[model samples]
Target: MQYWRKPLDADKIQVPHGEIHIVRDRCKGCGFCVEYCPRDVLELSKQFNIKGYHPPEAVLPEACVHCQLCEMLCPEFAIFVTLREEVETIES
Candidate 1:
């Protein structure tokens, strides 16, 4: 999705990034998060958890936008997203 013109504050604006966390044993393999993620950040893992269910894995951890959709949609409350802190370094 490219724009013909970029926003004036584009350089100043910071896009929120997110880090995804999954509770493997708590996941029931419903795949709600994988199916509904807007960024396609999650995928069903081939390995089974303690409960014999394939939990979701963060296949594209960098793509998350901190929307929290995965956390809200998970039936078992197994997934959550946290805002990733950006450390800017000052160049001498």
Candidate 2:
């Protein structure tokens, strides 16, 4: 997205990141999570799960913004997202 002017605190503000977890066997090949993701983060996997259903995989894991939309939309409760923690290292 382009803007004429950037936000004054843009540099100071941090965008929340997320990690997506998918329970392959629990998925019913429903594309609800993939279809409803606002960031287009997930996609239907070509590989089939234990139940003979193509589960969702994170195609763009880094793009997740911790919105939890995929978790909410999933009918089978197969997917969920956790906030990615940022760790800083210090050198003595």
Query: Which candidate leads in TM-score?
Result: 2
Off by over 4 Å in 2: 1-5, 87-92
Q: In lDDT terms, which candidate is top?
A: 1
TM, every model: 0.82, 0.83
Model 2 lDDT-worst window of ten: 83-92
Clashing residue pairs, candidate 2? none
- Candidate 2 residue-wise lDDT, 50-76, digit = tens: 999999999998778889998988889
Cα lDDT tens digits for candidate 1, 36-63: 9998989999999998999999998877
Assess the local accuracy of residue 41 in candidate 2 as a C-alpha lDDT between 0 and 100: 89
Instruction: Count clashing residue pairs in model 2.
Output: 0
